[model samples]
Target: MAAFLAIIRRDLRLALRQGSDSLMVVMFFVLTVVLFPFGVGPETGVLERIAAGVLWVTALLASMLSLDRLFQADYEDGSLDLITLSPVPLSLLVMGKVAAHWLTTGLPLLLAAPVLAVLLHLNQDGFLILIVAMLLGTPTLSLIGAVGAALVLGARRGGVLLSLLVLPLYIPVLVFGVSAVDAAVMGFEVRAQLLVLSAMLLSALALCPWAAASALRQAVE
Candidate 1:
């Protein structure tokens, strides 16, 4: 337990020291969503209709921008080897890093969503649903992204490879997250979509850390 907390604290402190990663993610998310209105034309009805999808897609892309660095820094500096040799299970330690990633990246995106939603004129229900869905979904993204990051460790063009490996896996979260907001906007019950989002989160939480830890072991072997 102490090791898990220590790992989390270590990653969080690293993130704080190198603050640009989180700042860049938030900036990319905001800029990407802001561009949509200009490209699609400023029609309130159209913007409202597509707002949820736009936000989710942009957030997914923004999250991807930081994933390449998830393990790359530690792997390059031999820190990953020391981490693997730690008494803590590698999977639990990996989960700590994943948690820090979500806290730094996902949480800011969640906070920024409302401002973008308003710019897109999202319905009130959709606004609320947007927060709820992102809350449930983004942590799952970080979890799955950790696996991709670990898998591509030390590979050339790892960012490109990471996108290919992770984007397909991200589809389910995007689909359900957008659907939940859309359902709420349409006055339909969003319980089912949120439930599916919860299920995905639970599934990712159970599987991704172990997969990532295994991949990390392979990378350092």
Candidate 2:
């Protein structure tokens, strides 16, 4: 238990010390949201209609911006070797890293969504649903991303590779996440969508850590 807490604390401290890492992800979220108005023109109806999709897409892209470093820095600095040698289970270590990744990347994206909502002139009703969907959904991103991050660890142009490997997997998450908000906006029940979203997230939470750990083991080998 102490080892688990220690790993979480160490990663959180490392993430805090590297402040730009979190800020950059948040900035990307904001920038991508801002571009939507220009790309789709200044029509409120159009913006409102697609705001949920736009916000979710922006968050996905922003999260992708930081995933490579989830393992690369530690691997390059040889800390990964030390971690591999630790008595703690590798999945626990991966979970600790994923937890930090969520804090540094997912939380900021969620925090920025409301502001992004205002930019798109999103309805108040839609705003909370958007935030809710993201809160439940982005953890899945962090975990699924961990797999891609691990798989591409030593590949050439790994950033691009990570996206290619993970983006397809992200589709259902994005679809359901966006659908939840869209359903809310259209005066439909969001429960079914949220249920599916929660199910996918729970499934990913169950599986991604082990898969990522296995991929990392292979990468290190």
Tell me each candidate's TM-score: 0.99, 0.97
Instruction: Write candidate 2's Cα lDDT for 1-221 as tens digits.
Output: 78877887888898898789999999888987898899989999999888888888888989989999999998898888888878898988899899889988999899889988988887788877888889999999999999999999988899998899999999998999988888887889999998898999999988999999899888877
Return the TM-score for candidate 2, rounded to 2 decimals.
Answer: 0.97
Model 1: residues with Cα > 4 Å off, grouped in runs: none
Best by lDDT: 1
Instruction: Report model 1's TM-score to 2 decimal places.
Output: 0.99
Give one digit per residue, the lDDT tens place, for model 1 in 48-119: 999999999999999999999999999999999999999889999999999999999999999999999999
Model 2 error, position 125 (Å): 1.3
RMSD (Cα, Å) for all candidates, in order, is 0.6, 1.0
Task: Flag regions of model 2 displaced more than 4 Å.
Answer: none
Output the number of the TM-score-best candidate.
Answer: 1
